[model samples]
Target: MTEKALTIITQREDLPQLFGKRIENQAAIEEIISKIEFESRSITFDIETKDGQATCRSLAAKIASAKSALDKAGKAKKDEYTVTTKLIDADRNLAKSRLQALQDEIRQPLTELEQREAQRKAQHEANLAALGFVNIQAHDHVGSDLVKERIVFLENTVIDDSWEEYKSQALEVKDNALRILRPELERVKKREDEQAELARLRAEQAQREQQEREERIAREATAKAKADAERQAQQIAQESERKEREAKEREARLIAEKESAELRAKQQAEDAAKREREAIEAERLEAERLEAKRQANKKHRDAIFIAAKDDLVAGGVDEEVAKQVIKLIHENKISNVTIKF
Candidate 1:
């Protein structure tokens, strides 16, 4: 509403002949865009005003129509060009195939020669590589043994016509590789020798240090043992006086105990002898008493046996037979006829 609400009413007469057609009119489209841009400046869209909103709707409708028409036109043109593009591509591909075949046929011998030479060159390169020609820096830190192997391989390589036109190149490569590798091998050998010598020196130093350490330890131990022995001797000397006194006291006490023990032993021996004499006298008296009892028993037993034998003789038994019967009863040879003694 700052300006007056305005609209541009475009008709078909204002457009180019190809404006919504299958052809693109660059100049005409540019003119149409110029005209719209100039007219759009006048049409200020103010949504707060009815007339401004109406003008904005009309311009939007116009732009939408133009956009639709342009899209349809592009589609129409593309649809028509599709067949022509396909035909051109088919002819281009066929010509490409035929021309490629002819070119291949024409260059067949050259191609074969080129391939053979390429293979030959590849073999030469492989041989050179085997001789350690490439990546020489990779061996800068390698060991002497590997470097010697490379030198040996380079020296062993036969440089002859079998290498073909590259024979001289192969020789040069071999020579250069050997030139680099030989010095490297020597350097490596020198370095290894230095390393071995260094290690030997270190080992000898370590052995010397170890021996020194052992000797120091042994000296320390000897000193410690001597100190301990001195201390133990001092302690033994300190204890010797007390031990001597105690030993003398113990010997005197043992002597007193021995004298008392001897006295007790002599008294015990006399008591044992008296007890033995009393036992023998008692035993002799008991033997005499036992003998008297045995004599009395024998006399009673004889009297009983004689009385019984006389009764048997009176009962008409023979004298010798009665004697035998009495003897049998007296000796307890007859059952149930023992005389009580």
Candidate 2:
């Protein structure tokens, strides 16, 4: 019981609010309040003492228990047992409010005294905490544009007496936040560049494939024409040889010989055309093979870079900074990062 601290709640006007509203079981309410008052008398206001703190804690617990009992007996029980809702509400609200108000009156000065050092600390700490996060992380969920906007806003923020003695700490937090944020923008930019390069490669590959298709069509048409010519010349020589063996054997023999030479020329021409088509097809296949190899190597290397970047991001590095780091590592420029081929 705080005989010394109790003086703070002893104003003559305070006694009226404690017994003001007429409610059910007034006798019980009065009994609880009386018990609290008697117990509080022994709680002599020495918050600096360990026993004083324990007494204050016990007093707070008792107050809370009493408040709960009063609330349950009125606000909730009225719902279970039959009672006029309006009447119950009025009485219950008044009882609960009076109880809370009385408790506040008793605790106000004690609380103020108890939290003196903490209050002093909180006064500056609140401002320092505000300085650290002021709109810096507020725009994070919105997107990069808003985040960038917030960074600009933070940069423009005047760091002076408003931040108090925590100006340097505030500035450092802001700088660190920006350092993490700036890299995401860079990652976006670099990703776009990579996409553009991949697009160019795809376009070039399409063009080469199209050109090869057209050339293949032309080669097939040429081979067909040469085959037709060779077949016609072969048939003519066969007929000429047969006629020479039957009538005007000598003259027919020379005519057959002339046909034979023409047949030889046609066959040679057909062979040459076939060899040319094969050479062109081989050249096209070789080119395609080289491109495929190059693309595969590129894909493998890109996977490495992407994996490195993603791992960095997972480890809490900013996205753009991670991308840049991967690039530097792959290029053998960043010796500090623990990465390998």
Candidate 3:
């Protein structure tokens, strides 16, 4: 029997190259189990002789004989003795056949187990790839469905090795990887939803503000229109009042002009009547003064005529001549009164 490291010794050189890696590391294989710890299945090696020729007790003697033969060969090499060995020559062919069968029996289970392990590792890597997909950038959000499945798969596969110190660390690493990636991804998704909602609220607020501003503008316009209407009304009232005042002034002016004209005409008529009365009074006074002077002259003439007649009667001239002289004396009455002709 030959000896080597557990991993290298168990490998089947005759198997297909593609299938070799599957069984290479499994402890189920006889060669691989032989180099493992004391609990390994192939902890002891047994030698078998031809059937019916030797029992279990004789098998031990055969192993002893083989060991002795190998020791002789080593000593002979040192002594420079050349000895032809026949023990290996007689039984090597049969031993080779038996060893080949035993290794095949062990390798069958190892190949199945390794195939299962490879599948598990492939599934784990696929899960990792899905979780760490480049499409899911740092700021992006993705679903956790695939990642959760991967975690479940890893948990199931880790059952047998989780107790081992080295495997426990590897399991912890897997756990940590999942722990770090999952929540942050979920949080990013939540934040994205919140941002969308915030945008909606802002849009609504802007619309509301615009509506309020429009309403305010409309109210202001209405108020301005009302104020303008009020001012216009006041202006109209003032204009109407001014026109009425003008009409009243025109009426008053006409009345005053007519009254003034009537007063002037009445005063002129009164002045003309006064002037006529003064002229009449003056003429009457002049007529009375002339009549009194005429009366005094008539009385003086009557006295003088009486005196002239008396003188003519006393003188007694011839009858005819005396009569003519008396007539002359009456005509010349002033002469008898010492009148100067």
Q: Give TM per candidate.
A: 0.40, 0.23, 0.24
Better of 2 and 3 by lDDT: 2
Highest TM-score among the candidates is held by which one?
A: 1
- Model 2 has an lDDT value of 0.71
Give model 1 RMSD, 1 decimal: 23.9
Tell me the spans in candidate 2 whose CA falls farther than 4 Å from its real position.
Answer: 1-97, 105-151, 164-166, 181-188, 206-341
User: What TM-score does candidate 3 reach?
Assistant: 0.24
Error of 2 at 42 (Å): 64
**Residue-pair clashes per candidate:** 0, 7, 0
lDDT by residue for model 3 (164-247), tens:
434554555666656765665576667667888998999999999999999999999999999999999999999999999999
What tens digits encode model 1's per-residue C-alpha lDDT throughout 77-152? 6766788999999999999999999999999999999999898888878876676553543655668877777677
For candidate 1, the lDDT comes to 0.77
> What value of lDDT does candidate 3 attain over all alpha carbons?
0.59
- Candidate 2 clash total? 7
Q: Give residue 200's error in model 3 in angstroms.
A: 9.9
Better of 1 and 2 by TM-score: 1
Off by over 4 Å in 1: 1-74, 129-155, 169-198, 217-341
- Candidate 1's displacement at residue 237, Å, is 19
